[model samples]
Target: MSLETVLILISIGIAAGILSGLFGVGGGIIIVPSLLGVYAFTHFNSPYIVHIAIATSLFTIIFTSLSSAHKHFGHGNVEWKAALYIGLSSAVTVFLFSKIAILLPGEILKQTFSVVLIIVALKMLFDKKGKHEDPAEKKPEVFKPWLCLVIGALSGAIAAFSGLGGGVFVIPLMHYLMKVPFKKAVGTSSAAILITAAAGVISYFINSPAGANSIPYSFGMVDTLSAVPIIAASIPFARVGVYINRKTHHYLLTKLFAVFIIIVSLKLIFF
Candidate 1:
């Protein structure tokens, strides 16, 4: 690889890690568009370019989410029950839909990804701030199973299709509809992304071809050469993101996430 490519990948990793930790997202939002941007700049020609980008992004999320999750766990922000509930449901859909994703046209996937990003960005921008719960009011001890199933299916399907982690959907559901506290929602989303992304990775690998169709230094759809350096670069920064998140105000974090999402959406649409 060229020096320019190396620098780009490393920069993407650093940014992705910080975003993942701060927002409880899997960083796929940043990673996918960045990978696509690189390929576009290099004029890389491959029928599987989008597939490779998505697969590699999901693979990177495995490490990024784990690093973020560990920090969230330490702060006791993770809602273990909610994570487990959503994760189990989301994993099944991710595995099933990723197979379909592997066969879809690249243009179709890209368009779909753009649309999803737009929706997510708009939601973040307009979502109501969390209302303070009365101290005497009792919150439910458990999440509804039906709601979990619906969120998981939608999140997993969209996430698997775009190679973005399910945390994008999960965080919103937790924070907005479920009324989960911001920090706990982020922590739980990060934890659940581990499972959702893992399932998508497995499905992509299984459906990917070997031999001529596979890229050099790749395992199945995943580009190992790029993923390794990115993972390494991102891990340390994830801790930094978590620390910053703890110190940052919730309103600031929410606005930051919205802006970041909008920027990513525009890139995917116009790049």
Candidate 2:
């Protein structure tokens, strides 16, 4: 790859990592779409362009999510119990669905990904931000293990299919359905993405065709040149994002998350 391409990949990585930390996402939201654009604009023109994008995005998330999660962990925001249950449950689903995803048509996968993004954005946009309860006054309901498992499974399958970090749904699912505080949900989701993305990367590697990497220095569907630079660039930026998340209010985070989902959705649909 050219030095110019490496620089571009690094730039993309920096943005993705920051967003990953900021939103507790796996960085796939930025990585997948950006990679797709890069491939398209550079005229890579392979039938596996979408697959490559998703696979490479997932691979990058392995590093990005871990870095972001570590920051959240340091802040004591992650719910370890929830993360454990969700991550393990989702791993199975991600593995199974990823195999199926490889068999599906690329256009169908992209369209489905777009639809899911739209749904998530709408949910975030209209979601009621109820008044925060005083923690000292009354304790919230117990976090159900079964519910966490089910949600993990669902999120994992969808993430595997769409090359997402599963944060789009995972964060909202925890906040709305599970009654987790937005900050906690974000932290927990980041931890879960660490597990889910790893499973996705492994599955994609196994299921992908032997020569799927049309680009140089690729492993299966993952483009190593892009993955390395992006991963490196995203790490420190992810810390910055985590710092911002700690200082920012939840409402702002929600709005920003919603807007990002909408923008990415439109790009996927029209681009």
* Cα misplacement distance, residue 248 of candidate 2 (Å): 0.7
Candidate 2 per-residue lDDT, tens place, 13-72, comes to 999888989998887767887888787667787777878888899899889888999999
Poorest stretch of ten by lDDT in candidate 1: 129-138
The residue-level lDDT of candidate 2 at 179 comes to: 73
- Evaluate candidate 2 by giving its C-alpha RMSD to the native, one decimal: 2.7
Q: What does candidate 1's lDDT look like per residue over 114-199, in tens digits?
A: 67767876876776654343111245434777877777777688677777777766876776667677777888888988888888
TM-score of 1: 0.86
Q: Per-residue error at 22 for model 2, in Å?
A: 0.7
Using all chains and alpha carbons, the TM-scores for the candidates as numbered come to: 0.86, 0.89
lDDT of 2 at 20: 88
**lDDT agreement with native, every candidate:** 0.79, 0.82
